[model samples]
Target chain A: MMHRIDAEALAYSYTSGQRVLDDVSTHVATGEVTGIIGPNGAGKSTLLQLLCGLLSPESGNVLLNKSPLEQYTDRERARLVAYMPQSVSPAFSLTVREVVALGRFPHLGPFGSLGTPDHEIVQDCLGQTETSHLATRDFLSLSGGERQRVLLASVLAQEPQLLLLDEPTSSLDLPHEAAFFRQLRTLSGRGLGIVVVTHDINMAAQFCDRLVLLGKDHRLVNQGGPSEVLQADILTDAYGSPLLVGEHPQTGGPFVTAPVGGI
Target chain B: MTLGNTRFLLLLGLVSCAVIFTCSIFIGTETLDLGQAWRELRSLTPLSEAPTLSILLMQRIPRTLAAFLAGGGLAVAGCAFQALLRNPLATPYTLGVASAGALGAWVAFLLADVTAAIPLLALLTSKQVMAFLFAGLDVFLVYLLAARRIHTSPAVLLLAGVTLGMLANAGIMFSRYLARPDRLVNMDRWLMGGVDVLGYQPVLLLAVGVIPCAAVLLLQAARYDQFAFGTTLAAGRGVNIGRLQTTTFFVGSLITAVIVSEVGPIGFVGLIIPHGVRLLTGPSHRLLMPLSIVAGGAFLCACDIVARRILPGETPIGIITTMVGGPVFLYLLVRRRFSDWNV
Candidate 1:
């Protein structure tokens, strides 16, 4: 029942030889939320992509369930790990229900239509992400927050053990952001491994069980509990700016904020 | 679009195609009524006496079938190409296969006298054979130009294709300049596009080339749906991007080559049928491929009917499709459903 993905000492560069990620390592485990938090150009999105096998690391390897990530076929890996990018703009028209139903394609038998059970699972995913109301609407017609929730429902329909998301809540308003984190916790409670990349350090502090913080130089700066990683000195060093860390008035968790000009 | 309507629309399209196919046989200028034609078909009367029946059995039937196959195949190929490139305007024509085919046929026409004198030119004797060969060459050249970057940038593939298309167009112009006047008229007529064959030979040729490739495109229907968002997202959903791209491009090109070689690169059907079908049904490829296939066949058959009956002498099918399909496509474009059109 314990599922984990371990990425070890991964390095990567684009077509140009300049490396974006170097000697970076992290892990995501079931029943816990892992957050990759960083400043701009910190390779957070690239790391998430590497973790989910979207991009192969130039040097180093990823292990899923103690087996090499490259060993799994596309369908096999898809059944285990689902990934959601920062945004989705479909060039073709599809309704919310249809897009969510697409996640079941890996599990279906060859030339199989969705059975009653598959439909039920799709319906359940829509409900879980609070996107049931938008199930019949065109995916392109929804607002950013609504589309994000619908996408979450769609990925959840894959029934993946490990879910990796890149900045899933970046465009969401405050209430929508809070609602999304609550949805993540509920999934984590049900023994799913959820890894999210985001710029919202305060939300990450509140929601993440483990934080992997990357600095501007695209190197891991800190990796630990929210209380340890959200410290003023650590935050200031990683983000390359002056920052203040305090306690949340409501949840009493770590709260990260920045000074407007100076302090 | 919902999954439920995919089957419904396909059935509707099939019935429409069937109706159009049957009506096309009746509407042509052949003098025989259906009753007399049926009697002639049943009886052992020689075709020498049954003039109307001969026209019906020999000319219209085969010609109508060829139109159906060419239209359906081109539309399916274009649909696959569009989805593969994620561009609405993409077709095999965009990739230079049609232009190369046109040049190949023109070259064959120009070299007709030289084919017997030179052994090597003997193999390229028929326009169909030469057209297919040059289309394959065009595909190979475009592949060579775009293969490395195609994974990261599909625009490179389109650029290579467009460049090749321009070169092939130049080749066609040079060949036309070299051709004799009689050959020029023949070449021009072929260029204009027609399904005026009198027997089953052309129909059989198109069937041999089209049926299997279009079947492959149909099999890849769901993968096309996954690709609508882009390659990375498609890969995340368990599609093998390499395999899908290969199948979409190669199979689509092969279908276009087959159709273009046989029918002289008929335009508008490949470019518009899929979009027109998307307007009627939604954008699901499962619905799009088969519906496009049937609707494309029907559209061409209707156009061919007009081509045959509207004038004292027959008009080219290409002209009718463009003349009719252009206004209809624009009407569909300006109409209600395209508000969701992204590609």
Candidate 2:
């Protein structure tokens, strides 16, 4: 399989002269769900932005399919990668279907007149994300979890080869969070590469094909299978607190817990 | 069912516009009966003794047409400004474009009167040039003041526009102070925004200026809709945000300039029509824009008719619209509190 994402010595700094990503380099394998977990301000979102080509890195380069990301045109980049931001406010009170149809913009001209195939693809995306029932509903009227699902449907409507999601389940309840991760797994199984940034380490341990831990200094500290990398010491060190790490009896995957201090 | 409801509303608006337009043509300073109006309209040859035909063709036709154009143009311009600034309260007057246009017309009027007396600058007898200069200068000031930062915040832009508008209003008041007592009445009538005094020349000029600008605004409806979906989403959808913003502002300001030049700052049409249409059409510019044009046209025509017949002589249509729009706007605010759709 082809390598979906290749980063080498990536570095980024905000205007505040604070570094968010420091010489970070990692590869995302095709058809795998790579989970990025870190404390707040660890540059997880910034790194995802750089990888998705939404923001150019201050140094180093990101390559997709062994080609420099800058080499692809805007439309080509959109067809190849879809980025779902962490927080967004819907400015217009559009229906869920209308918002999802915007994913076809790269394939459309300035007017965005959708063709027959575009309609079919949008319907398919809504179906995949289980948002078909909410297609005609007003987007602003939906609950937070429902809005997240609609946004995911919009991203899927692009039919992108690689998907980047930042805190996709941040607002979702436990059951919806599990269902969303399952949908991500199904997408990965279909040969689509996925990179998801999450605060939920336990969820990452359960579903992620590989877990990449980021330290507070915005550097990659560990990268391996969940069972190998999610040890109690590493979890405590990354979180800067006392924590417990155990195995799920049923799935045989790592499960992390924060324990009382001096444990 | 929703699509059917939308079509029905659009059809109703169109029919109302037609009826109002016809009534505006028939009822004026000198009323023309339907038979006389029809005969005058059907006649190809000019009747030497037909005073009614002459009056209809010369006075009412131009005034009615001006009302239609000004109403529709201002409403569309207002809708564009509201969408571009992302504020519900934005209008040509509030944004300073109308004030600027009024300044331009005032300068033209003063220059025309002065040039008529001075034989030296007789070559500059054309008042149209002065009007154009005033509008151009006003829009330039608005753009410069509101565009300091690369990231155009709608609130800041609107604040700048309003500040400039107040400055222009001050300039107009200064001009009024300088004017002789006799010209004050004429200036008052112009400021009140009556349709009675306009001729076909200014009406044709307004049509020339506004139609192309409105067409450009209509074509950008989808881009505006994406913009309404927020700046980042618009960019993600492949829109060049800077370019879209510049184009929308330019076109919107151009239409506002033209309407202000002809009608002298009719209020409330721009502020109310777009929001009202959004409530009916669900905030999509695809439907809101066309509906705004139709509803604006009808609303203004109806206002003008009421202005003519409400008393013996014609009152300014602005008075009628403001009086009506204020209560309706309040009612809408109350209704919005109960409704789920807050656009």
Candidate 3:
């Protein structure tokens, strides 16, 4: 199958002169979990935004299945890709089910009245995210992990072909993070193209099909399999102080950890 | 409450409000029994013998109906504005729409005869045209102040609205200053707001306008649900954010403007009723919109009743609403501090 996303020389900047993403280009294959890793302010989120068509590029364009992203209407683009932000705090206290059902907006008409299909999709998404019990709970009242799950459920309800998650597990504990990634793995296995932006190199190495390393100048320094991308020099260069990379004994995936540099 | 229980309670509240409305007609200064009131209502008895029935049917009934319609319209408008702006503090008054409408009404009141003589070009040629122009101008000002380089923030929108309201109030004071001393009473009474001054014609007009608009708003409830997630998410989910915002604001402002034109500027019925309904029925606009309308009707009817019988003559309904709504709102704020409600 052709790649879901093909970007060529994509660049973006917040202001007129300051470039946040500089001449970055990459491709995301079908059914692959592509992880984007970079230090803080490395423009990972900006790149994700560019890919999702949330921000138009200053230089190049992103192609969704060969067609330019800009050519698609907002609804059509939404049906093709689901982009989840790093953290979303709702201004009002919507119930978990109400929030999840919002994903059906694209499918509904101008009024967005839900039919049986919308309700079914909402139910499926809630069950898939293990938030069926929390459906009636207030979204604002949920813990960070639970909120993440509910938000994920909302995105899943969109049922998009490409899933873009910006730091999905940023607020989760180790166990929850592992479980979350496990769910992502299951999703990718179902032939959904997933692109997750994260700073957790070890988690990326374990779950991702490929890793795209980003640098401060909004450039892609390397892109390859986890074994090639998670090298000690690459880690140190990317993070400024990363120490070690080793293979996990059970999974045989690369495990990266930062050592205390000089006391 | 369970969803079923909430629906049940809402229905019960509606029935109770209707019953209270009927009872309100019977218990005035000159008390009439329900039978006499019914006979007068049926036109079987002369109104002169039953003064209370006459008052209830002719004066208080129309006033109460007007109060109900205006209150419901304002409250539902507030709910739409609050959701559209994503600010809890957003209301028709806070957004300057009420003040704009007041300015429009004031202009109409001041230049009752001159409106027909003014040419289109000359109409735009003076500061007196400011009041007539302020209604549309205030909306533009709100849009300009709220919008930043990227998009509008709800907090900024709220602040902009407050600023516009203050400016309109200043204009009101200036208009009052220019008027003769004899005219001050009319200005003061209109500024204070009352449903009693309205008759069946305006009430009928309000009913004609509000019922259809309310239905349209109710139909768009699901869009509001999508919007509650955030603008980006809503947009990403295929909601035309700009279109939705424009439609909601236009409809909401129209409802508010009509009500303000008919009555004076009633306060807080919009702000309090919607929030109160949201507290009972969760924040689903599907439920919130309809419930706000019903609750608003009940609340305003109750308030109008209190305004009428609380003293010798009827006090302004606006005073009663604020007097009751302010304390209730404060109580909710205080209770939220100790409770699990996160809104």
Highest TM-score: which candidate? 1
Candidate 2 local lDDT, A86-150, one digit each (tens): 76666556789988987887787755577899999999999988899999998888988888889
What are the per-residue Cα lDDT tens digits for candidate 3 across A74-132? 88989888889887757676688888988887777856677888899999999998999
lDDT for each of the candidates? 0.82, 0.78, 0.79
For B1-343, candidate 1 gives per-residue lDDT tens digits of 4456666766777788889999887788754487887788789789998877888888878888998999899889889877876766566776788888888777777777878787766765677777877887887787666555634244566677778989998898888888787777877888888888878988998998889998888988878877766667678878888888777767776777667767786776876888878777777777778878888888888888888787657898877776765675456546644444563
- Calculate each model's fnat, 2 decimals: 0.56, 0.31, 0.52
Query: How much is B165 displaced in model 2, in angstroms?
Result: 4.4
Candidate 3, B1-343: lDDT as tens digits? 4668877977876897787677555555556566756766677667767765777667777877887888889889888887876666678877888888787667656665455477773455332333335655676677566545334655577678877888778877787887778988977887778877434887887897688878877877877877676676776676667888778776777787778777777888888888877777877787788888878887887777777776658688778877877776567545643122234
Off by over 4 Å in 1: A109-112, A259-263, B1-8, B33-54, B93-97, B111-167, B328-338
lDDT of 3 at A247: 78
Shift in Å, residue B87, candidate 2: 3.7
TM-score of 3: 0.84
- Worst 10 contiguous positions by lDDT, candidate 3 chain A: A254-263
Clashes of 3: 0
lDDT of 1 by residue, A1-263 (tens): 89899999999998788888989888889989999998899899999989888899999989999999999998899999998888876877789998898888778764536899999999999999888988889898899888898889888998999888889998999999988998999999999999999999988999999999998888899998999899999989988988999899998989989888887
Candidate 2's clash total is 0
lDDT of 2 by residue, B105-185 (tens): 776666767677776564443434454455556666666755565356555766777788788789889888988899889
